[model samples]
Target chain A: MSATIHRLDNRPQPSLEPMVQLVAQDMNLVNAVILDRMQSEIPLIPELAGHLIAGGGKRMRPMLTLASAKLLGYPGNRHHRLAAAVEFIHTATLLHDDVVDGSDLRRGKRTANLIWGNPASVLVGDFLFSRSFELMVEDGSLKVLKILSSASAIIAEGEVNQLTAARRLDIGEQRYLDIIGAKTAALFAAACRIAAVVAERPEAEEAALDAYGRNLGIAFQLVDDAIDYVSDADTMGKDAGDDFREGKMTLPVILAFARGSEEDRRFWQAAIHGHRTSDADFAQAVSLIRGARAVEDTLARARHYGQRAIDALGLFAGGKAKDAMIEAVEFAIGRAY
Target chain B: MSATIHRLDNRPQPSLEPMVQLVAQDMNLVNAVILDRMQSEIPLIPELAGHLIAGGGKRMRPMLTLASAKLLGYPGNRHHRLAAAVEFIHTATLLHDDVVDGSDLRRGKRTANLIWGNPASVLVGDFLFSRSFELMVEDGSLKVLKILSSASAIIAEGEVNQLTAARRLDIGEQRYLDIIGAKTAALFAAACRIAAVVAERPEAEEAALDAYGRNLGIAFQLVDDAIDYVSDADTMGKDAGDDFREGKMTLPVILAFARGSEEDRRFWQAAIHGHRTSDADFAQAVSLIRGARAVEDTLARARHYGQRAIDALGLFAGGKAKDAMIEAVEFAIGRAY
Candidate 1:
């Protein structure tokens, strides 16, 4: 649900390369549209926005848009603008997410809020958000606008929900899942769903793509949360135990807290409440999470969603596009290993 | 260019009451939609949003929508939701503006950012923005969506432009006009223009309403800036000299700086560069501004736009609605006295 970078460097495993290759041509057009539309007469708008937009994070959401268009076998260029719009929306949310979290780092780089100040970040985020709508409006599709706009509202609502839920262990798994669904998965679902709208495909096909993207998004986020505990900044491009320092109740904490012994539970309560923040506390926390096998189960749960994401494509005719899409889900799940 | 309450308690001059009375019944529906929609299961969103939404500022933008609909004699209820959408956009901008300015007070009340903090303000602003788009999509007019969305983008761009131009004396009246045109007048133009769209009026009428709004919006903002030097917090519900304290390059400051003596210029430069922020400095600023008649001339400039705003309605039939709209413009300019 947060703005942690999700690319994997784990070699000799399933990879997102297939989907990347499949959508390479379409993504180029989308990138052009993104660069062109993000420009403004106001230089700082582009300067602050480019810091994050041209930042090194993978264009996962837009890739879903392009890849879904391919999976439908609908030959049209309308999705290119829409794909750019998807990226703009994602970038806008990322900017705001950094401000909301008081985050210093994203994708191993200083956040826009840190570099440009929250005021510039907030306003540029607004500029990009509005520009995204301009792109959707230019496409002149009410259906596409509805899908993306609704996802945007849901994303904001989910962010607020997560904000209120922060540091509260009692929020439980269902509430946490709901938060991720809205914040992370809604845009993914919308990104894929709009391709069908642009391609003039049927609702069933749209729903199928939505399912594929939504489940994949969840799997991706679950892996991302799991990685925060195990990977140092050198490997994952994110500091280890960041979520723990922030007292984020990712599934690892949720499971460990639920399954921990009484003394361990006491430690977790202090940790989530932010009393435990030192190296020893984090090490102890990692040991507790390992003892409870929370990280393993979180990945196991991600696989459950990853399988659903793959199977959601079952109705689509098998082809290179479909194979790449399936392997993308596998790659998302495989990242945890 | 910043969020300040605009309602006038000054009793003897031209008034917005006629237009308020003209749109009173319709405003009930707009207000209803506003209350119903600002709500979310996330209590903080509604709680924080309601602080600003229910805050005592006049419903100036939505009132323009309703009155413009009356000016065109449009008989439909779609505008109620659309007007609410316009207000949502306005409110969203206000929320973000407060965050950007680090403002503690708005409409004489503590700002939502002050009450709930900046993160809540930023996210709730986002939610409201997305909700505005959803409302437009529900109305299903691509034209209205385009106008509003384009205006939205321009507003954000204008805000960024203003941010960059802040405290910089080089941004002359032309640049200042451009800034207010985007940050202040663009939505006002959109609010009125959309009424014409819903009325199914011709392009000429839409353009006329847009001009009426754009000019009146500029006039309103100019007077608002003027009043920053004249008004006291107790009477105007805004802190006097806020613009002075923030080193805001408002119209009065621009005019005074342009016309001041060499010594006055240094004081003005020092003031704008954050070297002077005490109440005595503000008193000196007001004195120098009065010395150059900058506030008077700023009001005169507002009258120029206000006259154009009233004259823009020349083609419409003479009636209470048109009279009310013209009186609203006069009310805006008259508030400066």
Candidate 2:
């Protein structure tokens, strides 16, 4: 029943042993601060938030916040507050995203929407968002507020783009990157950059941390798409091929569909456009994806980005924080089971 | 053909000597700032925002912001930015409110949902909300941000409360006031108080402006409920008795139902609780409301709040801004047809 207990027998062996140890150490401090800041609001908010926060999420956003601040040589404890703020914003968006996507499961647990009604989830999400802004204002840093606010706007716009792009097979790679960057990477980048801003890091170092976060987010999303059909429900926290069932056009599916024959095109049109897909349809789609090696291709792209994320962090001087960040990028792509 | 021109003509007329000039001058500056701040990276965002911003609703929130600042003897133009920020937040909420309420008409024009679809309106409203925070961050005042963010949180909570209370006629007057205060008055109060904060006024003056805005907002909502039952679509820009049709429990209906006879209670139970209301049910409800003089009694309460709003201004020294604010309170509760 423990969501964080992964079945490690089938997991990939990570090469960054030293980095993993450093991240494990930093994560202890980050987790404590997150728990403390999450408790500052009223009981109702934390009660609702606890359902998701304690549900075994990776806490990657907050980790980036804390790690980037440490890498930038932050002497103050405000980075912990900023880290908590980052996680709160990300968590709030997840709560709303589940409602909008009508998702039933998240992080291997029943989503907030499945437990509470959509209205409650939405209002609670709003509460978390406002509370995050209130926390940031308390820091009295206009630069941090501006960066976070703009990132929030970008995230909302990305969701809108995804809404319009759902089931649209014609959506191109550039548009997909834009959408994912806004929805996922913008927050990741903002979280890391804000930590650097708080630490008063050099401009080049701040930009490098931002780039690292962005690339890591993109690579993470790529792996998510690659695992859609291959990962089991127990591992992925949802039914296999749910995106295909919902007519969502992910990268692997798009690539597979593009390489399919005319008959295959008809099959996709029947499933995606007509919304008449069955288990047999899912089987056939999986077969076509395997035949085209779309999943393999997608994973390759994810690895490339993962490497780029690690390379970006080279701008900062090597340290435990930098090593942990590098390990995070690798884990995001495919190391995590 | 302009929505503003028609709506302004039907609004209650004051002496049109000093208040009119002041409102116009304040609104002109506020409107320009609003137009400037609404621009975004996404083209459709600014376009959708422009449609709503130029849609001709009364800029009451911004006016309060400006008046509060002027009364505090603000010598700089930062108040104009704050006033515009207030209006943007209000407009953004309205955009989302119409979608949440499933409304089809606003200011005698089609709702944003009717024009661009619910997704666009909802997302654009979010953009505006985020933009408002960005503008406030530019002002470099953490106190103002805290007040506005808290106001926004309360507003969202109020909306959720209203959604849960819908079609439930058992809601009492105090509960209704709490709901309306959260939904309407919180932002208004924050807007006024923030102006004083920006002006660096004394604490006593800031509290008074907050109280004044709060009372005025409550009075405005009370008058709005009265208009909903009595005014036609042509004048009110919405269907008459819309609240009743939606099974919302407002002040007059709550009071009337409480005083109704057994037979009258049965009628209400069937129409509201049973959800079997028709034109005949509406007519009967209207007649019962008239018979009980519930609308008149509600108007009396609104006028009381209007007077309280004027009294709150006693903390400030008398000036043109103070006079306009007092007159604005009177106009809020007075007839608008």
Query: Highest lDDT: which candidate?
Result: 1
Which candidate should be chosen as best, given DockQ against the real structure? 1
lDDT of 1 at A285: 93
Q: Which candidate has the highest TM-score of all? A: 1
Model 2 Cα lDDT, one tens digit per residue, A1-337: 5432212112354444544354465667666766665562234556667899888877778777867877877778777667777887888789778766778988788888788666566666776677688778877788999999989888888877777777887876777788888989999899889988988878887788889888888888888877876886888787777788777777887788788888877777777774656877788888888888888888887877777787787677766777667666656665433
What is the alpha-carbon lDDT for the whole of candidate 2? 0.77
Which regions of candidate 1 deviate over 4 angstroms? A1-12, B1-12
Q: Write the per-residue lDDT of candidate 2 for residues B193-260, one digit (tens) a residue.
A: 98889888888988988998998899889889888767889988888777888778788888888888
Chain B fold agreement for model 2, TM-score:
0.92
Predicted chain B of candidate 1, TM-score versus the true chain B: 0.96
Q: Chain A TM-scores, all candidates?
A: 0.95, 0.90
Give the per-residue lDDT of model 1 (tens digit) for A1-337: 5532223223357888999999999988998998999899999988888888888878999999999999888798999999999999999999999999888888889989999899899899999999999999999999999999999999999999988888998878888889899999999999999999988988899999999999989988899999987878777766888889988889999999999999998999999999999999999999999999999999988988888887788778878998888888878878667
Model 2 alpha-carbon drift over 4 Å, by segment: A1-12, A15-48, A72-75, A266-276, A317-319, A335-337, B1-20
- Predict model 1's lDDT versus the native: 0.90
Q: Which pairs of residues clash in candidate 1, taking residues 3 or more apart in a chain or in different chains?
A: none
Error of 2 at B75 (Å): 4.0
